[model samples]
Target: MSSHLLSRPLLLRHLPSLSFPLSNHRFRPRRLSSSAAVRPPATPEPAVSVAISADERYGKKQIISVTPQIYEYILSNVREPPILRELREETSSLRGSQMQVSPDQAQLLAMLVQILGARRCIEVGVYTGYSSLAVALVLPDSGILVACERDARCLEIAKKYYERAGVSHKVDVKHCLAVDALNSLIQKGEAGSYDYAFIDAEKRMYHEYFELLLKLVRIGGVIVVDNVLWHGNVSDPLVSDPRTISIRNFNKKLFEDKRINISMVPIGDGMTICRKVLQY
Candidate 1:
């Protein structure tokens, strides 16, 4: 808790002087007797300080309430390169721009790719290639990203930006349903070949994608699922919408799943990270 909201001194300074009529007897303050003296004010609790960092790796459940001011502060301090910033600005005005991952989330994805020493990556949804661009930019010279997306219009925008970012050679854009692309990878003996996978496709198909991605990533490899909170609808029991139900059920299944070590991180739209610990 911060005194910035309303401090005692500030409150006292703004408070108006009061005078009451004799007729308002009920509203008069009651004086305490000597025997029933008022208790001394208790000591104030220490305020918890939070440090915002773009370079540091976040914990599994680490989260904070993101007010507009806090969001702005994060954007200001976060280290985003010029090419990435330009791409973000270009994608911000699209009709389905909301589908693009936040800059913080994109930065985290890029960091994860480097931290994991990932050489081959898979992106389940490629909405204007925001995430794809992020991951591709951080990858090594030999690194490659297989981006699976169904929307041609979005892919066109993503291709333009990818080329602009100079990562077009690294990203293999598959303009088809994510499931088909994932299955094709498996069929081509590419199972357990990838180091990381990012899932951000259709909500109803999360479970299906998770199963396929698990097989695609090798043991000890990481898979990050985005929008696990579904705009905080999964936790609200009253929200029985199709997407909400799908996300809720998907979360339950992930919890019960024993093949991987899971961490449901509270980041952009709530990302759930799963590390494959067993061989299929």
Candidate 2:
């Protein structure tokens, strides 16, 4: 464990931060030929509102709300692989489909996997396998993913999609509690073997999961915790729901911990990226 976990510097040398820049050219609509009949606009366009709400402006930075038009624009720009599209559509019809990660989040996860050069990963909650598929699709042929999901039905759906995506062999589905599975891995001397671990399981167990994952992952490995915002409930003072409270406290603990560096990006609910920087 010491030798494996202490290889942080060597791993860090292989990984670098990545960025993508958008095209600078402004979009322009093309005019139809005079020979073609001009079509009338079907709906009257609403005036663009300049007024921004308090929630729209966080501190000095302003962020646009995900309006229908904005969502359409985003969907039009991001390319979704056919297998991912099919799996997403199928998951949309299932009960509690909202639990599945958004396409943008899926894309981000894939990029993270590639940037990290990750081969071994762990998904704490595999809800129909959208995220699992996303990460697995980007991993190398010899890569492996340990997917933990207690729901057998959900695991079945995930397996079917994984097979269709041609990444079935890369994933090992574990139908058991996430804590149990993570602990079992540690007990079997698999600590510091995983390159990444994603936590989207029971909210109350997030802290517990983090503790276990911190010990299991190497110093350079990353652990991404989803829904850290708890649907905008974490920061609300009046909202005292158990889950919300749990997430709020967990976020505080994560912020104070020195073992990992954190960036709580406001994407798809909220994703807290914790990169291990110190050995346990």
Candidate 3:
């Protein structure tokens, strides 16, 4: 096992927002230790929308602490293209402009896709294509990345970025509820055909996505869900925020799930990675 949190050096401040689309969302807590505890998501969506803890993806997870050198090394590996940089600026320039994915998380997304050798993949959300670009860059040349996003403005940015990245040919950006898109795919008997999937859309509907993802990904395939840490509120029994409660419950369910092997890593906010192991 790695060293304890106390054994680490002085952690640096968040990457100085080097890119236009970088953010430590409002749910972020501005304190740090060798280990950092994340804040949960507070965005209000339709009650019927997916019930994921959006804050958790953007919120920093309670880290047990890795060395500063380790942290820097991870950040240095993420590539930031000039076209993506310009798109980030354009999206953030809008009113109520709310599109951002940290550099580390985006790079991590790429790593996951490559490691999985993902071909048929899905992304529940695509904000400016940073996440889409990350995954698309690493997918096999013949791979297809289906991005389901509801916001046209965000999709516009995502499209622009993918085109700029020159991988637009490999991506399919659909404007619709992620669940709806999956349902349509299921109708075509596309379940269990995808090799990897990422969920970062409406938080409340996370459970729904997980259920469908299990069907879409074959055994040994993986489904990576973002934002399960929910900032620091998940552990607080008294914090009755519905979103926080939902995430807490999901984490519990994932652990008991004999269908997959799970790991809740302190990578970003908290990424719950489940490698499916069962049939059904």
Model 3 spans > 4 angstroms off: 1-16, 19-74, 88-99
TM-score per model over all chains: 0.77, 0.79, 0.74
Clashes of 3: 17
Name the 10 consecutive residues with the lowest summed lDDT in model 3: 21-30
Pairing residues by index, what is the TM-score of model 1?
A: 0.77
RMSD (Å) of each candidate, 1 decimal: 16.0, 12.0, 11.7
lDDT of 1 at 137: 90
Misplaced by over 4 Å in model 1 are 1-64
lDDT of the structure predicted as candidate 1: 0.78
Q: State which candidate, 2 or 3, has the greater lDDT.
A: 2
Candidate 2 residue 252 C-alpha distance from true site, Å: 0.7
TM-score of predicted model 3? 0.74
- Best by the TM-score measure: 2
Put down candidate 2 lDDT per residue, 59-128, tens digits, no spaces: 4444344433344355445556777767776877787887888767788898989999999999999989
What value does the lDDT take at residue 195 in candidate 2? 92
Q: Candidate 1 residues 1-280, lDDT tens each?
A: 2344222111111001111113213222234578876464497433322445565465444334454334444544556666765666676667777788876788788898898999999999998887899899999878999999999999998899889888899999899999999999999999999999999989999999999999999999999999988767787899998989999999999999899999997766789889999886
Q: Quick one: ranking by lDDT, best first?
A: 2, 1, 3
